[model samples]
Target: MKLKVTGQNRGFSILVLVAACLLLLSACSSGGNGSNGAATSSQQSVANDATSGGSANEGAQSSEPVDIIWWHAMGGEMGRAVDDLVEQFNSSQEGVRVEAVFQGSYDELLNKMKASFGSNAVPAMVQMNEVSSRYMIDSGEIEPVQTFIDQEGYDLDKLEPNITGYYTFDGQLYAMPFNTSNPLLYYNKDMFAAAGLDPESPPQTFEEVYEAAKTLTKDSQTGIAIAISPWFTEQLFANQGALLVNNGNGREAPATESLLASEAGMKIMTWWKQMIDEKVALNLGRKTADTKKAFVAGQVGMIIDSTAGLKGIVDSVGNQFEVGTGFLPRPADGAPGGVVVGGGSLYILKDATAEQQQAAWEFMKFLAEPEQQAYWHIQTGYFPVTPLAYELDSVQQNMAEFPQFQTAVDQLHATTLNPATQGAVMGVFADARESVANAIEQVLTGAMEPEEALQKAAEEIQAQLERYNMTNG
Candidate 1:
């Protein structure tokens, strides 16, 4: 389901920096945002990591070179890509050096961050996810980036809100989007054609999805498979006007508030239950590979997954089936919401020296450049965070070669500021989402009626929200 965003007034003109062309610079800083020593220290740590890099630079500053450490979750080629970028930056600069370290997956990074904080051994810079922003910001462990942007004299307007929002708390911005991605509908053209469905025209609406699923379901096949997590299902419910939380901030607003138990939510769960009962959809395990495998093996007609999964799908499917990309589907007449974004951001850790913070800001602005952004877009299936990145020659050239990349960009134009799309603002969001997922499982497995299951989930969420509010809000 497409989570819609209500389009705000476009008063700020988007500066299109065409790479292989020109670059622009502007200055800004954190305005009207509260600050704490812990948060500043966190931000400094992030800055320190980027500035110190891999090793101590052999320079003439303070008679010795300083070093900063970075802890990140990126691995394999992607991890290498990050290290290479750091290497390039370090080689290009002469002051402080930056070091890149690969820790593990998302969960591991979180654990490490918590442990380091307890030990007062936090790294200089940390790679953080969107959902974790609230925790870091509230913990007073992260520093706002707007100050860094201002000091660096970089154009704030050059970055997009979708990219900026990941790091924003209250009225201030903390982190910067490093690798953000949106979910897209992936289908096997061969399967569609074999099922007598139009390979070119995908199901754009939930009704169409149902029809297509029925037509695509086989004796040994599941027509559609979406992750059992709220990540995927939230999009569907968001598209249908069911909010997972009260505020439009994606569980980042008030812990005291709750909204998941609305009538819209009930309707959404009912539909899911009906889909499972009638065998039109398959409730696959949340294993990422399993979803892709089902699609590649032709066991499922449609898979709603990340655009980042495109390469895996292409590789797995090979020439066995035709692969097609489409936007996330929505209901026919609800407030059209776009999809929730997923990805990580770069946060400056507090406690870094001024020089390191300056150096880190330089690297961030460097990454924001159109050329760097285009390179990232090509290497990964993620959409470029800036509008100008789309206008870059590299991006344009890439779209010419591979058209599927356009779907993600086109969704940006369709974005609206709906509660569903903007996301929830609550404490313990991760835990609350797990509860929601458990409720979904119960419905999918026929352990409970969808309405009852979701209502129960809402009540539980409300209870949690109240507890969190008492403590955090």
Candidate 2:
């Protein structure tokens, strides 16, 4: 539900934000041009009231449609595909018309939302990363999604439980998870074959990963590479019985404190040190893209990265060599916990009129529909948030042919809502992630032992959490 691991890509593009702002400002200033300006609340109100008062049997009588504005980050072919689906929805419903807006990256979209909050001109609906859900909910600027679910009579159980857990805070649901994914072990099948390993059977455990890496390691090359962050370390720690925070509901319970400095954590770090010493594992900078590219180019034999990297691998290795996907390794005791999902969800803005909310709800439901969710999974390589989608014939067919997609689905269903794996949730997640990333870089650079680096990271993170809890709580 949230992808805020240390070094995870933050919606960090500044230019996109600036350009969006300028475009919006220009649209606002040029009132007569109906191209890009947001709809006025008065306009939306009139439409909603008209639709509500006039339609118990709108199917019997034709009426003007409700136009809902949705701003999203999906673009390129994916954007066009979403737009096509919206068009289909428009044609299917006599009461609603959804306009899909392509905003930039998650970070850029977040900044735009902040700006809109100040101007009282936010979009009716926006897709936000799971990590930022708490802040949006705490601001009281967004509606609790449970209200809509209850009002609309939607079944809560229809969605994945782990996905629901991501958007819930203080026992209230605030977002509808649109996409969810997790890291998988992607390996060069060609390299595995050359190293006398079975390409069909990838690394099943960390011990095997080490041995396979030893075989795959070459000049100016390492056998395996990990992007240092919660993506690798947290899941690995979970496999080894380590918990970074207090055991309970993970970030859900503020009473529980962090345990990143605990014995289990120390053991995890010590093992990382050994891997480094053995020269089987190297720390590439904390970019998922860079590490993924290193693996695709055969610089590294294996990489533990998000399953979302599937597209990149397919693109880079198109007929170049064989690519293999497998579940993340377990320790001797098996996976410490279920693999936590990492992705984003959609939240409704509070200021939107009830009619707009209704319209937005339709779009949200559309996204969650079995067909659309399957399409999203097929396009983005993220897991379908709903199980029914996976049951669709098309989804099953795709899985049968692709095979790689099943790795994420299998791990996702196997995941549990444990604190050790569900991920840390505190107000200063962004800052805390930065602290962890810096500590990781320090350790990988040989400036500090993993234990010392992690200890410093724990102190810094705890301090940030204390300050955030004090202010936000």
What does the lDDT read for residue 425 in candidate 2?
60
Candidate 2 clashing pairs, residues 3+ apart or interchain: 11-107, 238-336, 239-336, 338-415
Q: Can you write out model 2's per-residue Cα lDDT over 247-293, one digit (the tens) per residue?
A: 35355466236566666566566656667778988777777878888
Per-residue lDDT tens digits for candidate 1, residues 123-174, read 7778876677667776766667877766546567888775565456565778
What's the lDDT for candidate 2?
A: 0.73
Candidate 1 Cα RMSD (Å): 16.3
State, as a TM-score between 0 and 1, how close model 1 is to the true structure: 0.82
Q: What's the C-alpha lDDT at position 178 in model 2?
A: 84
